[model samples]
Target: MSDKMIHAYSGDEIDVHWDKRLCIHISECVQADDPLFEVGREPWCVPDEVAKAEVREVCERCPSGALSYVDKDGTPEQPASENTGQVVYNGPLYLSGELDIEGAPEDMPGVRFRAALCRCGASKNKPFCDNSHIAAGFEDFGAIGQSGPGLDPGSAASDGPLKIKAIPDGPLKMEGRLTLKAASGRSAWQGTKTALCRCGASKNKPFCDASHRAIGFKSD
Candidate 1:
């Protein structure tokens, strides 16, 4: 996935930019308003067909930051909140806010307001979701465990650069202000650091329950 491939769609008040490599194919844009994002049509997206506000709202919902829009005034839309992550129901781990993903692909954005990281262990795009979870029938309820003390809601609000270190063939070690949420928008866990499972073999679901070692899951 070359970082140079950027698809731009112009509108009356806003211009939308899409990085196909970052797209997870969650269909959030299409579901928001099909007329503007018809799958089989040329150009695929017609931003002018919908109100600028509506288009912006839909684009913001993209979990992978694959969709971004620039207003006529040249202002770019920002993330809704601070550094945070949410485990989608039987899907990828959705993240947003100030983030610095270490060791990411050269083509990937250095920083993004949102991203969908693969937790299902099936995505061809490592660390990023590619909608392979759907075809793989991945399932998880994102249950929290009785581990160490998690972060307080107030503490989780700190605006800091979240650091995500992807371990070669291992779990994702994260540090900095973070609020881990569940599918129902409930806080499952909040902390400044954590080792999250990526092999999808953890008995603890999102957490590293040491199942990766037992299963000998290799990723490097």
Candidate 2:
């Protein structure tokens, strides 16, 4: 704990990125209501700004490995995982490192859902990955999903719904009893099914306008 330190940085590291695994469950970093860390959307703790002793106290309390820190020089330190030097993809966010389709949630009795989240603001089906980013030539090298809802594990439901399947190197394949919503707050629940965009390049806001294809949005 004494050896731990949190360094302060200028705005030069704006390009610094963090994914799900890197976090240390240091809820303070992500808590906007009272930002103690002041560096992230939610604040946690920064050692260099404060005292080294205080930073170690906070880091030691983390329940999950959700929080991590970077050095002043911009180099990264290893976390406490047995798997070292893994080649993590910079894009196409996967849940706990699992592919999308296998754990996708079905619309049903369960509360969880399988919807895409938008990384770029160019998605017609923003927050959901639709192929629109690709069709529209929307580029998101650091982007992932760019369309479609996240997949959940276990269970399935069927009540005359539009079925969604994952296409290889394409937008999500949806065909079933589902609805599409527009930016105007209007919704189209066409039980027939539609492929929504996860890439945020859609002029359509929430539906897959196929703009990603035109934009050439690719999830690396």
Model 1 worst lDDT window (10 residues): 103-112
Model 2 RMSD, rounded to 1 decimal: 14.6
Clashing pairs in 1: 151-190
RMSD of each: 3.1, 14.6
TM-score of 1: 0.83
lDDT of each: 0.77, 0.34
Q: Which 10-residue window of candidate 2 scores lowest in summed lDDT?
A: 82-91
Q: Per-residue lDDT tens digits of candidate 1, residues 8-69?
A: 89988888888887886778988874477888889889899988888888888888988877
Give one digit per residue, the lDDT tens place, for model 2 in 14-39. 21122232232335444433323565
How many residue-pair clashes does candidate 1 contain?
A: 1
In model 1, how large is the Cα lDDT of residue 67? 85
List runs of model 2 lying over 4 Å from the truth.
Answer: 1-116, 119-162, 182-187
